[model samples]
Target: MADQITGGCKCGKVRYAGTPLDAAPFRCHCRDCQQLTGSGHTEMMPLAREGFAISETCRIYEMQGGSGQSTYSGFCPDCGAQLIRRSARMGDRVYVHAGSLDDPAQYAPERSIYSDAAQPWDAGSIIKAD
Candidate 1:
């Protein structure tokens, strides 16, 4: 991953730039992730919240996370494209959707989260943590 990460919504209504908190990204297979992404999982890259900057305010959706804390999903109101995810349990970082990155191909998930929640058809996609 690049030292400086940048990305935006489909309509370019929402944009963000930040320093990566970790080089190893992860795939989330929680039901909320599947529903939010309309897929089997969501690939996420972590960014330092202190270094993160957003061009515009995003529409936030709040839900209870697996940790029993509040989780927030940030997206473009205009394009309805999901861009970020943050949780009360992990306040120091924000997780950016890999697909929202300017260079999606650069995203390579190193591990799978919520692996037990993976759908049968997508079970093989999970990457066990090293």
Candidate 2:
């Protein structure tokens, strides 16, 4: 992976950069992710909070995750693009929305989470059928 990764939101607002690729990207299929994204799953890469920097204003939404811990979701104030998420499950780390990356293809997810809450069509295909 590249030494540095950078990206921003849809409207040129809420730009950010993360370094060192702290953790492998993963796909989340939890109902909260599905409902918030209106998609089957959401992809994210965990990085140290200190290594991440944002350039614009963001709206943060805090909610309780399935683990009963706080999950902070951030979005671009202008275009409503999802930017990042910080979960108590991973302290000192924040998960950046993979889709927000300039080259998201590099952050392929190696695992899937919250499979029990995945939709029927998505359940059987959480990971590729290798």
Candidate 3:
């Protein structure tokens, strides 16, 4: 694991802690990520969906992606901060946006997914995934 990365939601309405090395981080430029995060890309860590637990209230909303796959996003009900995202097909894995971390710098883009959809400017923003 990279390190002990523990963080919570903006309002402390939710919390999550994990070993950074336990789940590799990844970056995605897919349209779904872009639309959901309101950013060009989403740099996040991938964890077993069950690995995360919340002490506060959270709500989940599921939507269909451009790829026609279901995408689920979990957010803190109080602050409405998107906390994590995962899909049924990728059920075992949940991707948490690095920005959601109390200390965003704790993680860097480990690998880039959907690179073809990535803007040229968003390229070269990756670290070793292994």
Candidate numbers, best TM-score first, in rank order: 1, 2, 3
lDDT scores for all predictions?
A: 0.91, 0.83, 0.72
Top of the candidates by TM-score: 1
Q: Candidate 2 — which pairs collide?
A: none
Which of candidates 2 and 3 is the stronger one according to TM-score?
A: 2
Residue 54 lDDT in model 2? 79
Residue-wise C-alpha lDDT for candidate 3, range 1-130, written one tens digit per residue: 4455566678887887655436557788887787777777887787655556656477888998666789888888888777788886776777777888867877766577777786677666533346
Per-residue accuracy of model 2 over 1-130 as CA lDDT, tens digit each:
8888888899886888877455667898889888888888899887778768877487889999888999989998789888888888877888888999999877878888887788987786586424
lDDT tens digits, residues 75-122, model 1?
A: 999888999999999999999999999988878899998999999999
Residue 107 alpha-carbon offset, candidate 3, angstroms: 1.5
Ordered list by lDDT, greatest first: 1, 2, 3
Off by over 4 Å in 2: 128-130
Q: Pairs clashing in candidate 1? A: none
Clashes of 2: 0
lDDT agreement of model 2 with the native? 0.83
For each candidate, give its TM-score against the true structure: 0.93, 0.90, 0.76
